[model samples]
Target: MSLAPILLFTYNRPEHTQAVLDSLSKNKEAIDSVLYIFCDGLKENSSEENKSKNKLVQQIISSENRFKEVKITIQTKNKGLARSIIDGLNTVFLEHEKLIVLEDDLILSPFFLAYMNDSLNRYKDFKNVGEIGSCNFFACGKEFPTYFFTNMPDTWGWGTWKDRWNKFNEDAVFLYKELEKNNKMHAFNTYGAYDMEGMLKDQIFGKVDSWAIRWQAVMVLNNWLCLYPNPSYSNHIESINATHAKINMVPPLQNNEPTFETIEIKELKNVTEAMQLGYSGKGDYFGKLSKKYLKKKTKKILKSVLLFPLPYGIVAFFKKNKPKK
Candidate 1:
């Protein structure tokens, strides 16, 4: 079997870059696989501290030679995470039909490469299989099969074919319009388990710049399924300097080799239900209501206060000036 090329994206997090690299180098197929490292350039007028950290990260990747082949691309200008990933994937896919991807903040198990290669090879011919992912955020329990399918794609540690990746539509406006036109917003949000629609809007409105959300939109719109190992093969170690603030308590990485099989393309019902409940919220009725509904309402109220502050300021002044009863 031809091992898929591994693409690693890094920025100024030296410790994260080094830790992920060390864990990846220990994978069983690391010696046989090709590794491509993309070091995004520093932003304009970057602080000296950031520049030094970026240089350290570059130095770390320069000395690495554990893979069958090592290729490095150091951008002279910052392309941001979205542009960096899209551009990097485009470049690698030109030579390889399929490849595995890793960011700077994930630790992989020794069997991570083996599982990715096996699944990628197994599902390469299946048009409906959009991605082979190693990060399973929800705990579906031991009853779940060795591997199952989900409508959402996981980018932490994933593999995909060039053909499928080509279908990724980065146009936030187009994606949002299509989802609304088709009345698939509810389904796109994993039955209200997540707020993917809001994220898509954030992307559209320039509130956030996230490639993963766009990628997820692509999968959801196409009705594609991403395969995930029961016991995830990757662990996301949240960094102090991480871009996003979502902290997930990922299940422990699978220490032993994982078993993969060719399952039907349909998503496992039990697993999907579990994911819905898990992502809906933390606790009971109030938790769900607060997360699913009140959060958005609160954001609107805050935005209103920020936008029209004079009236709110007057009220605040009067309340403060009024005697404390």
Candidate 2:
């Protein structure tokens, strides 16, 4: 079997980076797989504290060689996460036919690499299989197949073949315009739980920078799909220190190791009721809603505490307009 290389992207969180590396190294295929670590540089005019963390991350990766072959790329100029990932994928895919990808905050299950490599080989020739993901955020019923297909692609811990990845368009405008021209806006949103069109629009206006949203657009435009192993094989830590981190966004689902020896791949044209529930914010709606409520409530409370020096009326004004979470 040809082992796909592993590409890990990291920024300033050294502790999270170390924890993720330790979990990855525990994977059975760790010793045989090639590891490619991309350390993004500090953004221009970044604070001293951020620069310090970035340096620490670089140092930690440099000292580790857990995989069979370790390759490190340090960007001299800050290429934000999205650009760094786009560049890394293009460069690495050029060398290897397939590769597994991870970020600093995601911790892998011991079986993650095995499942990814197995699925990669199983569906490599299937033009519809764009990528294989280790995490399944959807709370599909306990009885669903151990592995299944969906049009949604997850970026947490994933792998893809060169051909599937080559379809990605870096130009958000190009993708948005194409989708708009085709009258596929509504269809794209139904493909997954979230509003992909809105995300693409944000990307176009520079409100947010994300490579996954564009990739999702490409997958929808090309009628491609992603395969996922039920019971997530990876856990997202979502470090509080990471910039723009949305902890528990989609919240991690239960992780279960499968008993099956082989994965069966097939075409799934429609979203399963389970997939819909999971993605549509309805699968685990109550639990997810509770989490969001708590997070928002806590943030508001913290703000109130921080502004205690203000007049009682001012704080009372904030309390009065508080939206029900």
Candidate 3:
């Protein structure tokens, strides 16, 4: 099998970067793969502390040559994650037909490279299949198959062909307008359980800068399918200083070795049963209770901290006013 080049994007987290690289190095195929590391520069008006951290990240990447070849690119100015990824993928795809993408926080299982390369080779000619996702967040119990098809594409750890990626629409406003005109907004929201709709609104309104949402929208708009493994080949070790920390829906299940040699590609339109279990926020008690419960608990804790004596006094007053039992 011809190995796909690995493109890893990183910021100022040196420890996270090291851990990710260490795990990747453990892959048997990684020794034969080429790695491209893109280190995003510091933001404007950034503190010296952040700049130092960014340097540390660069140093960590440069210190390792775990792959067949490692190339590093350091931006002079902060291109931000969205632009860095967009530009980095664009630059590398020019030289490579297919590539695997990863961030600094995702730790890979040993079979990650095998799965990605095998899937890329298998689905290279499948026009409707857009990307192969290595991480599965669905808590579909322990009785699931080895792999399955899903409509949603995940970014935790993934791979794609240049042909499929060419369909990506970078302009959010234009994509949103197209969705609105075609009356696909409802379907889009339904496919992602309102998550895609909210992300599109935020991206267009300048409330947030996201590239993954836009990529997913482009793929969905074109009716592309994503292949997902049942037991995820990667786990996201979220960074503490991350500006946008995603809420984990379930505990990541590990699969160090998974075989897809004889797996058939089944294009599923509505795998409602499995998808419903995947999105915790859309169907169950955990989804309903997560945000509201956290908010109430935080408020009570703050009240106790700020109005310590007052809260206790009020509690005592309320108890004293109760009828004797």
Candidate 4:
């Protein structure tokens, strides 16, 4: 088996599982790498048949790909997403120094594997880089072929070494209370503060459950730079009412093309470059769509167009034009 395994997590959604696996099979380095499949056990409210059918998801995830780069971890009891990922990762790390992770829904480019492996090897020793990501949400504005930047961390296609994974504070013993007292919640605004460690306190206290938000918080607070592509590598798979997206912030692609990559090992400037790229693209579309009534991104720009009273503006917009009350 290869030293690094392509780690995959799957639940229900057999079709999505199959689609992502198909994409992985097409990836440039799939033949040489090992695929470590972690199939989560049956969930609550699911009938026995549904539980048994859970095998289908696993099969779809690992099916027909019995090559050098394929391994399976089937859980008998349901561990949930949080436990499964953190614990599954622990298991994977025991045998592999580095891991490339993916969920059942995510699709990747052929170069995605190549890029992630390259970054892992190049930045494995870079103290500031906690993770090497295969995805970024930035619009590839005025693409200059390739570039690098830091940003809010994503839980999509990503790779990391055992060193950084070991550094993760599972207990979150140090930073949780401090992050709250300092009013630094804004700093960890990848998706929202709901994803912040602020919300993870309950999960830690046996009140709730989650996985990724806290991990992102751990990585971000430690001053670790999460490397990202300009146009994003793996597109989100669970877009419509799937498990992950809470508010359905499925905005249209602003500048999806002209995606950026890293041509060489270079010191990153700051997270500003990626944000700048995204902002400029949206800004251009804001003006570009002002005249056209049906232009995309107009709704997004206008949704947050108001300055103060953010909640009120959003509620008012949603409540407008009643459906025959």
Best by lDDT: 1
lDDT (0-100) at residue 107 of candidate 4? Answer: 73
- Please give the CA lDDT of all the candidate structures: 0.86, 0.79, 0.79, 0.64
Give the TM-score (vs. native) of candidate 2.
0.81
Error of 3 at 303 (Å): 20
Candidate number of the best TM-score: 1
**Per-prediction TM-score:** 0.85, 0.81, 0.83, 0.73
Candidate 3: TM-score? Answer: 0.83
Question: Which residue pairs collide in model 3, if any?
Answer: none
> Tens digit of lDDT per residue, candidate 4, span 1-325?
2336888888777777777787777765777778888888786688877766687786665565644657788888788778888888898899878998888767777567766777777777777878877555543434422446454555778888888888776665455765566555556554241345546666567666666666766776766777766545666665563675443222223233343344443434333543443433332211122233345657667666655467877788778955775
Tens-place lDDT digits, model 1, residues 189-251: 987878989999999999999888888878878888999886889989876677874764456
The segments of candidate 1 whose C-alpha lies over 4 angstroms from its true place after superposition are 283-325
Candidate 3 Cα errors over 4 Å, as ranges:
248-250, 262-271, 280-325
After the best TM-score superposition of candidate 1, give how far the Cα of residue 236 lies from its true spot, in angstroms: 0.6
Worst 10 residues of 3 by lDDT: 280-289
Off by over 4 Å in 4: 1-3, 143-145, 172-174, 180-184, 190-198, 201-208, 238-241, 247-325
